[model samples]
Target: MNTGDLHLLTGAYVLHALPPEEHADFERHLPGCPSCSEEVRELAATTGKLASAVAVVPPPVLKQRVMARVAAERQAPPVVPRQSRRGGTRRGRALSRFALAASVAAAATFGSVALWQYQEAQDARDAARRTERRAADLASVLAAPDAKAVSGGFAKGATGTVVVSRTLDKAAFLASGLPNPPEGKVYQLWFADGGSMRSAGLMDVSGATGAAVMEGPLDGASGIGVTVEPAGGSAQPTSDPLALLTLPA
Candidate 1:
């Protein structure tokens, strides 16, 4: 996906309407692009609200009243529309994607917009706080004075890189083009030390890529490794590391 179209994807991404790869690409794009991230935050304000809100059953007579009213209303005359080619332009396609996403979001809350908006404001504030803390930590890792990067090829086409910073005693991992593990499995990160692999954390491959600031301190860790493990991870890797990158002392 091109950068131009990405600017138009915040709505669809929040709506979960984008395809898997496109979704991952947009996620990789988020941290670097403040405008796009802010747009996602704004568009996602109502996300959890929809799922958590209790469903209110309408009165049994409501449907009948609406049907009766509809039956009495006059039907509009049908007019054939002219055929037009609007798909050839780039901007038009992007706009169409955004419009469709916006329409879906709008339709879900059509009758309760006022009440929903009031509720969404609170959720939005909470989401914003969490996003800010994550952004701050990520910024620190990227800006670390002694940061160094080690790249790993987990698969033929996949690239994984671990950036460790001695100055901040922190490490961060980023990978793209990684295939998801088999059913009931997930990719877990490890700190290889003294011939032992201690779990760092699990890699989230829900998108086209995965990234995280490695858990635990960077002390005495010889290297970082990736492995396919059971869903919740394991005390020790049951298989060989797909990529074992020795960290610089």
Candidate 2:
């Protein structure tokens, strides 16, 4: 079968509705097609949820009526085959194939929608977790007993603050009102202890405001400086500091 036809079977395969021969063929094709495999998994999960959430029970008399009809049909005389109706047989087969294709298309559409919803939900959850972590980190810095704040301005519109916890050995840079860097340049932080300068970290100042947290031994640094450096930042300061703040003695 063509790839499109094989993909159409994913919904049926997930529900265990495929014939044994087709099922085996799909299973073999699955290892090489990640798209089909993921579709099957998502559809299976949706099916499981539907099964668990809905309970259905037929009327007790329905079974008796079905059996009675079956008996009546079995007792009726079989119709003789019409050999001259070859064209009718072909037309009937064509109709059957069309119906089967329509059903497969509908099932595939439903499965694709379910998969998209599942992925969107997953992405939302991940974003929430990241936001929570960032909030917690900011709160911890703000609540620190020994936290000290330093502020400075770089260019005309650029300004920022550095919050440091001497005892906790952590520092956070909150930058705002900074212009976007020129191409192939980025803002970098430096810790100067009078004798030497150590790279604190790089800052992503792509927007009007951004923040970066530095964790390490920051107790001895006498000053914090910000400068524009090459994209990834340099091991040593290659440009004059655009913004500087002196820590308390």
Q: Best candidate, lDDT-wise?
A: 1
TM-score of each: 0.49, 0.51
**Global lDDT scores for all candidate models:** 0.71, 0.68
Number of clashing pairs per prediction, in order: 1, 0
Candidate 2 C-alpha lDDT tens digits along 53-124: 222333667446634543453221111136523544454334333433443444445545666677788899
Angstrom error of the Cα, residue 158, model 2: value is: 2.8
TM-score of 1: 0.49
* Model 1: how far residue 182 lies from native, Å: 2.1
Off by over 4 Å in 1: 1-128
lDDT (Cα) of model 2: 0.68
Give the winner by TM-score. 2
